[model samples]
Target: MNRIWIPMAAAMIALIGAAQASAHESLWIEAEHLDGVRGYCWPMGRPKMKTTAGHWGLSGPGWAAEWNMGGESGFLSIATGADDDKAVATKTLEIPTAGRYFVWVRYGDWREQTERFQIQIQQAGGQPWTARYGERAIVEEDNEMKLYWDWVFAWDRHEVELQKGPARLSLASTTKERSPRQVDVIVLTTDPSYRPRIKERPGNHAWEILQSYRDGIPDGLEPLAKNRPNFNLPSQWKVRTFRNKDFLYLWNVSHTKPEETWLGDKPDRVKVPYNIIDKETREEFEKTYGGRDDVPIFSDPRIVPTFHGVGAGIFTTDPKTGELLEAGKRFAAWLDADPNRNWAMMMNYHPGKPIGEKGIQAFRKYRDRFVGSISGESLGYFYPDAKAMQQATA
Candidate 1:
């Protein structure tokens, strides 16, 4: 939980007929899930990096939160840009009350903004939040970048009835504040799902899972570790799986509150919205936890986070006695999520100089002696996503 962010608008416009809109369908929620839902704020057709010196932001791509009917939900930004047209922009969400609800909107590619945009839910509100049945004002748009509507149930109770104390859900304004060009992206998906269970995670990961890495690792620690990748894509990659089809994820958020509200008018403040998952389905989550080999590859949290924090320490490297790579006795990285993106995370390790559960039981005895191949579920595994592997191996 660092600070919190969600700003960037320029242009977006696209809304026609709507026969079930499709951009390969969109939805994601990962940052260790299975309950304990936290960050959730959709609307990211890529859009980060405004001046990392000239372009470099929006790392991982995993946002859109609010499940379990808590509060706050609504998104949209953008108001400029137009090399030709496809630069309209939209933001709408209103469910003052109804009941069984769910919605998850996500967009991507930010650098001011510009894409086939248009999202609606035009008229309907007030009551307990009545607005279901084909969703009154329920408009949708995707343009073509993938990730448009991952889930939208709406059983109808009044539409989404809910009001007690300080409840919230918006989208339908008259301009109390509108500038970022004029409004490009914005959303409000009422708890698309709701689960809750949390445990792992202990240190590190306040943010930055691979920012600049200092141009080229001027020896930031041991040897390799240059970083400066992701937005470039290299240092190991692969691809396949129906060529992926579509996706436009974006991440680089923070929020656990930022001074309490307003979001400081601008200037790249904090950021939030972790969670990320999508790739058709992600091989049913590596056959439900890599089939389980006593399942101790750092407790199978995709090999112990390495990023995103919570419990760490399970080093290895004994190539037949090459020695000096045995450190265990510490672990943490469990998260709970709900809002239709169902979630839970993993990662643990430890031993002599560590703490807690003997450092995850000494990384489960060096992962049952010798790491064992390694698997924690990453979908097709092509890995490549440092910007689509730099536009598919450039």
Candidate 2:
């Protein structure tokens, strides 16, 4: 009875999952499928009669795959030498039936405002109609640095009437620039409600939360065992011999590539120091350090590297004595030697700690030291008052 019921339950679950997935499938057309043709070929400028021009091939690497639908890598680029010189790339797309369709062009704009083009579309028996399209200057410096191809959603949607069979879409550069405009892909859908897939920029809080979760470290906790400093020490210094149990162990703790060390040689034959910890010491270390069994712990008195600008290290001593050497002594000395040294600490506080007056003061101190943005959801607690929160957000 149990076996029979289980099979029925599993089949029902599979059917529900299939229904949910099928709901997202929609009718659409990809630009790469359209036939491409150019008046002139490459090298000798031979004329070709095909739909697509090999001369105006795919754009820069990774641009087509990222912007174009169906992960296509081909695009049509038409440039004109002089204002009178005509260079048009025509793409022929076959339609099932004559109807109204929504059109979208995946394009980028890095040219001057005056350097624009006209998109001409011709139905089966109809004459060509043109639409002027151009891009405006980006005000943000960071957004301007992105490749023009990365602006997938920077296009406007236009409605076009088609009469079934085949339609000719042409892109002709109206400017005199050497390379006027780039068209990654043209998407046409019968459903007027359809919207092109685009990447949305995350807000400040969302971006902060995303970055916080990326390093696999818990919120408000620093990655202690990952990415150690490259000290470039001799091979002999890689392994240290201790009098207790006569065990050879590695000096560094790594989440992956445990055999690698700052000493530059593989500790293939050496046993891990954490695995060889005595039962009593292991219990004590776990109690003091919160017994996180997920990551390997270094059981030696060594310097744990950090990404802090001051080159600080977390110095750990004997677990039984609970001794921790001042972690930032080396960093302090380095800063003292050069008073003008620009350095800041990458701090990770306890997640459970309340965001109070002390936390706000600490955040301000860190913000002044670090010349850039300090991101983390943990910092949100520093703004307890409503006005302070508003000011911080602003």
Candidate 3:
């Protein structure tokens, strides 16, 4: 009985040891850590020698650097000249007891340009298998200027099969000329669905709503068309309702830049000068009205028109029934009363045409009537200023 028990215990120990060995064989190779075969270097163009730990190598003619951003230790970036050159990084990893392994690559395209590259793996007694990667959807980076990098980990499961002992894993960018591709790291995992921990951008609800609108209309609404009038609004315009407390507001957020541009082309059309005021004029205006009874008004007309409306208006409605409330009627009446007031103000201070005393007074009055905080339930209209409305008609 003792002899039998000893043999059984030995067998269990051997199985546990094999499991540990298998786990140890998995690889996590950093691109910058690979052996630099021919021409890879650090940030200052310093030469990096080949080693078992890994190094970077570049062939042809280009520059490379170590970029540490988005919580990565240091990713290799071929900053420039890769368009006419090739960059490659290679490493030798040993597989203790390999069967099938999923491959995951961590990389980034700072420029949002789809960069293409290939991963070649040569097993002990097998031909090299090259898996191409790139043309991935551009992931929004916190910093889009390329001053900082936002790394994305894209993976292909069970894509690589390895044998026991040493295997040469390499990433080569030797195809068509283009911008340099960012390489962070490559991971091999027995778990097919394994994903490395990395920071991800927060989701925006407004974007989600916009995406939903693009995908399909909500229930009970008319099928959306680029040209459809609703509730006396012109074609290509509609009211979007929003509620706050007891009041519902009608908002028409439409694109009017094209129409505005066309209106500018007409000889008789009144063009509202936007961002035409030079810095010098703004400074003079501030100095002249530094502490006068009149409020100093210096704003980017282009932004102002866009912010207010091409025919943008907000009016109040009965929250429960969606019927126009008294406040809503009043708001509409105000819009109709002097439809040209807003646009006239915009055009008064056209570029090279300084704001006269009359223009200043008119702007003050316009501000008092149009711009105010909305509290509780209220009605409003985002109608285009009189000029835009006229242009639309013309």
Tens-digit lDDT string for candidate 3 (12-41):
999998665434334666666777644542
Task: Report the Cα lDDT for candidate 3.
Answer: 0.46
Please state the error at residue 62 of candidate 1 in Å. 9.2
Q: Model 1, 36-124: lDDT tens per residue?
A: 21222223233322111111122222223212112122322222222212222222233344333333322222222222222223343
Q: After superposition, how far is residue 64 of candidate 2 from its true place, in Å?
A: 12
Off by over 4 Å in 3: 1-25, 37-69, 74-81, 110-112, 138-158, 199-394
TM-score of every prediction relative to native = 0.18, 0.35, 0.35
The local lDDT score (0 to 100) that residue 113 gets in candidate 1 is 26
Q: Which run of 10 residues does model 1 get worst, by summed lDDT?
A: 173-182
Question: How does model 3 score by TM-score?
Answer: 0.35
